[model samples]
Target: MYISNVTIKNYRGFNNLKIKLSKLTVIIGENDTGKTNFLRALSLPLSNNSLDYNQKRLSVPDINSNCIKIFYKSIIEDEDQEIQLKKIPKVSVTIQFKDVKDFYETEIVHKWLTDADGEPCYEIRYDYKPKNDLDLLLNVKDMLKDCNASEESKWFTLPVEHYEYQIISSNNEKQISFNDLKHVVINTIPAERDDFSDSNSMKANNILTKLLVNTLDDSEKNNINSAYTEFFAAIEKTDTFKKILSSDADFENLKDYINQIECIPNLPNLRNILSNITLGYGDDFLYQKGLGERNLVFIFLLFAFYKSTQKSFNLCCIEEPESHLSINNLKLATDFIYKSVNKSNRLLQTILTTHNPTVINKLKINNVVAFNGTEAISLTDVSQNLLDYLRKRPNFDILKLLFADKVILVEGPSEEMLINTFIQTKVNSLNNVEVISIGHKGYKTFLDIWLRINKNNSAKKIGVVRDFDNQQKAKEDHDVYDAENENIVVRTTKEYTLEDDFVRAGDNCKILSELFGTEIDYDTVAQSMKANKTGGMLKICDAMLSPDKTFDLVLPSHIMEIVEKLK
Candidate 1:
């Protein structure tokens, strides 16, 4: 079974985070918003990975920097008592599970339950503490007990050389570890790392080597070793070697200096020989392939290897799948990852953190989580038709709206182009707010994202800008998006369409009519725009780019309201 819940506190860049994980969970956010930190934090409690212990160990850097700052500030506030009862900042992560089955799974999760006698639960907890020993606080206070200004200034750096941490069972108040058993494993593939490079051997290649070691039994290994040893022993006795030796004997001084130098090839066995195998297209090995191609192949091979080898639950955390990938290759890689987990018989779970829109386009809405530093946003109860529609058509840039601080949704490309120009030129160029034209698929569906997120904290502002066929439809649109507390504002064109409204706006028709170099009124301009929407918008936008020209084409008040409100 997969891990259902993860609760994190004061680790890496994450101040605090709690999010339920789907079997194939995708975390999308801009860089350094704790997406990678979230992945690293989830890796703490998991065991049975090749480098999990070494990678999971806590250091001074592992503790949240802000938490450390507050800890240093809070320590010596009370001078007389040396230390008060303020709780020292500590980092802890607890992962709860669902769908746990079988004796070993039950036994493993049983030891790490949150409560012993209260309720049936399954969780694994890890904590990094401030006080490694009883006298830590007292000694720290005494060190800074009495010091001059100069001495005290130097002593402000009160961080630990190394922090002590432990994995403990909440059920029994005892230190615990899952390393002794290979029941569960977690493997992390980092972004921007050349794991398959020849200059630096991949640390993860050890897993492949270990798998080979386990696969071949002792007798088979012995036979392979014997064959290599015998072949090496026979090399010196060959006729070619005898002739070379005889020739060396004639050169007495050289032969005397050498005494005896025998050729000994490196012994090959199942254990270490796999590393020597050149993998890739014939001449170009894995290290020599293009970075993107190598990365895709590396990921594909990794998933296949895990699928074949894993018996217990396996969780693979991949960060930034779109690194160095072309569109086709990225599609293939993402498709493989999702399909391998869901369609296979093996228990392989994947959690991905990405900055790429293509990754989000390939995933289900329910499985994608927006990591906005406040709280993760996950789509729930979304219709199946919409979910499949997103995957089928990747052109919709839902990801841009997901990451923006504020959003402006419009009807078509004409509105998108014009509004963007209007914002950049007329307004002060509000950078945080984004304008996305959703092609008029459905306005309400896009609002569902803000609905899930604004529930917790209604800080994210969303402006829905669309055109109505009639004034009656505008009233219905207003009623649909009329959520005051939700921070959403709906603005529709006063007339039937954006073109109709634009023609009706003050001096906009005169300006466009002058630019078109012909006499045109509201009806002619509106009908022409409706027929050739992109063509009409492109001509106006192309002229707006020139610094020598200026057109006082006023926008509809409602359009400006959506843009300015989001701003």
Candidate 2:
């Protein structure tokens, strides 16, 4: 089962947020946009000690040092309107799990310390039912405390203190702890190395002790270490270090010599199933292994461990999977994640965080959670209306608004793109012009909107650029065009002489091949363009450069050119 949604209030960076998760959800944003804290919020539900079967009391897990602020219901009107801030070490989450087709909801609460009044620490609570519904309230904390209080009873009380789950550490016979229960609920997605801090080693060890039986077996571990040492020594003997080692194997030259052999500091012990193994090496050896290989090994280990699990994880939290991986490798990593989930017997829900645009673009738009500094916004917000409209209507261009501004309707994307480039690069300050391709039928539709709306100063200025298909028909076009309309203009190119099907400008084609005999092979470029399966010539920017960089270059160019011509 996977968590379907999360809602946050008065948390770090978010005043209020409610987000629905997809099977594969990706969070993307700039630095300091609270993306990391968002992950912490999700972890809060499971972080509660009551869920830990082990009764060891510890501070709430501080993924980050910044504490969340809380407020009680206020009495005064002004105080109620204003934020009544309290140092909230306590946080709560409402976790909803899906089985078959139905949803089950539960609450997990965490607290940092006792309140100022010396009262029981205020814990965050996720109400399962709507406030107005008025049903029997279920308090997870009370249920857990009750279970811990009674041992002889069939129901085991959840513990009220923090400790790793007893069941997790290799002993199959141990009674389940609250910690084990929490871990089971949270383990929807396999944990990636990037998701945790250096303390991750400790956490990982604890997790593996429970999941991988061999990890807790002393005999198995020792035997694996011995085998690993032998394997390493044999591999080293084939290296340059081996030549140095044999020469220096001389009984330390008595007291005068130290061990001069340089070999890999340590190799991963293979005895433990995938998750429990580590490949530690000296800094010198790190350079010998490429970053790609390091990431590959890291992912392979996770993949192995994930495959080894008998039970499926409910949620997997991965941070920046694109790190140290190239574009090609990122795609491969994404494919691997997709395949890994599909292979699992249980429903695998993924929470992947990334800053890479390629990874962002690969996701179905609805699955993306975009952070805008303070909060995470879904693509659904922008596309909601379009998505609704499309249920009955097929073949609708939802992104038609992309060129909806004071549109300068043109023949096609190639022409629109070229005009945009020319306006921005050659023309100065064309703020009012928006270049759009109207694709014949769309041209008439846009023309009507332009005529009806351009009367007001706020309305967009409109222009039409078309091929003068035949010189004789040009008079009809010129006659219909009211020169008196200041908001609109029409332009035609004479290079084609009205006989040619298309315009032949400066370098014979819209895309220049040989710039003044430089011989750039424009045909090869055209072939490359064809290979890129996107809509129009404008997509060339996306193919050749990054989204941010391409948009930065094109928008101002078009605006400045139109502004310059209008002035």
Candidate 3:
């Protein structure tokens, strides 16, 4: 079974967040946006750890409610025996917490429902309460009543304040011990993973140790122990050991004091010794490698172990995999994760949270989830054709566009390069604003994508800067020419293009001659500019911003307007 969707309410920063998950989901957002919380929610249900439904886990805005609910939609195989018996196509698990008037009454309620393919299915509810002295008295009274020999059955009542597990199912409701659902395993690689730490080294060792231990049967273990005993006995008979004992005075004294001592080996002891041995390259241990390489190795090692031990279903949730990784390593790690999940023989699902642009750029856009502090917007909600168009563009960094506080969409590299310089000079910083070049056409398609994203995240400010080309017909047909949206600003040049606007705003001859490394007349420069707009604009913008040059250069009012909008 794989989780198809998750809903979290009043947990951490999420008031009510629901998101559809994929086989490989990549979550990206700013810090403290609940990216980690989302991962925790997914693992909480399947994990063996107890839930602490305290003030810290409650959303501050809804603290008075004192309830947190996490719901999951798990897609199960229809042919599975358990699913067939339950007569359902999917499984739904709901974990809820309710804070009663007294702290003693606080309890966790686990509810399981089977999705009967559009029909009503069975629902099972398990309520777990804390244990106390009051529970013991109620148990004795209930036992007496069951025997039907109670003289004061009316005088004794079942206590409400007690540890209890009551399972209410469609067939019957009764008190039963807590039982976990089968065939589900959830593992999480938290955000604070440290590869060089001693604890992390032991964790890696433990994973390998567990895998090795589980793979060997009793017969194999016995064979290993017998081999170890023979090896030890052979070592004792070797001339090297005899020579050392005969030559060393200390050995003779120890042997005299001990009378007799023998080196014996067991399977467990040998396994322990081997588990403590670190794998390395030549003289350097694995932990001694570079941080990024060590992290990658650790992840792959753990993943291999996890895959080997899989039962029926597994979920691997990793947070901030970009941590301690360089851009090249980040790309490699993402590719590795993607391929691992897509392996034909592996029944594995992966959820990754990352902030690296290289990682985001390498993933399928449809699998990306952008968290905006309170809500999550998946790129799958976008038109597939638009995403396909974006995927075809090899240079576009969509993460920058999605995560930036404000975005400036230009036409091509020349505008993208020049506008970045212009904005840096005007604003003294480009930290909050991102400049993206979308080429000349497809402005509307790109704008629509941003518009959908903006609808979900209202805090983003987007500005589109394009040229009018001085064609009346083109101006009339420009989709965003005079368009206005709440969070989006569109600005177009007043002249034929950016080149014509530059010529109109300042001295064309002086700018062109200084930029192109030649003295050319105004008509000659204009002809050249028209012939090669991008090349002319690059030279023009560069010369205007050059340190050795000084001129009365006035930016077009519209260009300055878009810059201000972005600011």
Candidate 4:
């Protein structure tokens, strides 16, 4: 069974949020946007560990509501049956919580006792009244007096308040054990993992020992024990052992203690003998490696052991798997995570939270979830064609758009370099914005890219700066594009092209003539600028960088307007 959907309400930072799950889901967002909280909420129902909802997981806005509900839709497919007769059941598990004081009075508790919805509700309910005859009489003295009861008479009986807790399924309100849901296990690899820590090493050892115990049969265990006994006997016969027995005071004391016992212990138990074994490569321990290498080795050992044990799990939550990883290692880790989801005999779903573009770029765009502070917006809403186009375009770095506070979309490399320099020199306040050159694709294409990016990152400001190709045509069609989007700013120039605009803005012809060491007129320079656009722009950019000249005199007002809008 794998989770198909999760609904979280009254949980930390998530009042009412529902996110769809795929085989592999990549969650990306800015810091403190509830990415970690989202993962914690997912692990709650499937994890056996208890979470303190009131203190740590409760939403402040929902404190008055006094409850937190996390609902999951698990999809179970029956492959044992024929395809025509197969059943795919969508099971629902609702984990509800109420303050301890209101545990009994909560509506969810009441529903568990009386609701006939045929869905399981795991909650606490209670039945309370008076306890015993004397206690009941004392509690209801007026009723006892009305009934003519006395100390000699039989004391009236009444029920006392007591709580009952169970996992009540919808099937006739039958109680089921929470262990019945053990098939769905949630494992989390937190972001702050330290493989070299003593606790983590112990955990790894325990997991390895458990896997060994479970994988080996009794016959194999006995064979291993016999072999270990032979090795022990050989070691006892060694010269070193005799030397220790004769010279070491500790060995003499151990021998004396063993003689005092009724029966000396046989060979140490094989399981306990290897319990303290530490993994190492060659002569160096795994912990002695670099942090990044250790993280990779630890993660690999965990997943490899998990896969070898043939255990099934519903969901795996991995936070920042790219942490302390190089680009190649990050790719390897992400690929392993993706491949593990569709393993042959297991149903595993993975949820990953990452800031690394290497990981993000490797994932399918449709499986991405972008989290703002208030909500999670799925990038699957973007047109598949556009995503496909982006995938094919190697030069387009979508991470820049996703991570930047604002984006400036231009036409080509010349515009990119010039605008970036301009922003750096003139508009120092807008340092968080990125200048993206989307090639020579016209204003419509720039708008299309802007819209696509806005769909996923609507909170970010976008600026589209394109040259008006024809001055006469622009005058007739001033409303060619809508200027109504509050999050976007569209800037157009009245001049024929960027080159023409540069020439008109300042003494560009004079600058070009001085740079090229030739006498060039204004019209000739402007026309030649179009013939060698990149070369002309490079010359102008170099001039701007020179301490002898200042290009600020030619700064365009529309460019400044775009930067201001972004700010």
Which is the better candidate, 3 or 4, if ranked by lDDT?
3
lDDT of 4 at 100: 16
How accurate locally, in lDDT, is each candidate?
0.70, 0.45, 0.58, 0.57
- How many steric overlaps are in each model, in order? 0, 27, 0, 3
> Which candidate, 2 or 4, has the higher lDDT?
4
Give candidate 4 regions above 4 Å deviation.
Answer: 48-176, 196-204, 210-220, 231-274, 309-311, 342-346, 394-396, 427-430, 440-459, 468-482, 516-523, 550-553
Structural similarity to truth (TM-score) of each candidate? 0.84, 0.45, 0.71, 0.69
Which lDDT tens digits does candidate 1 get at residues 1-567?
678878899887777888888788988876667888787787776664653343656766777777655544445455333333243557898877666677756765666656424546677778877555335556555665564332243333445543567776656757775553256667777785566655367533554565556566788878877777777789978998767766355666886555477766675656666555445455766677788887887677666666665466778888888889998999999888878878864357888888777787777667788877667766656767667667666767776776566778887889889878776675544467678877654677677665665543455777877677755754585547655445788877777788899988888888888777646788887877777899889888877766878666788888887766765
In TM-score terms, which candidate is top? 1
Candidate 1: C-alpha lDDT: 0.70
Mind sharing the TM-score for model 1?
0.84
Q: Score residue 76 of candidate 1 by CA lDDT.
A: 45
lDDT of 3: 0.58
Clashes of 1: 0
The candidate with the higher lDDT, 2 or 3, is 3
| Candidate rank order under lDDT | 1, 3, 4, 2
Q: Which ten contiguous residues of candidate 4 have the minimum total lDDT?
A: 68-77
Candidate 1: the clashing residue pairs are none
Give, for candidate 3, the lowest lDDT window spanning 10 residues.
68-77
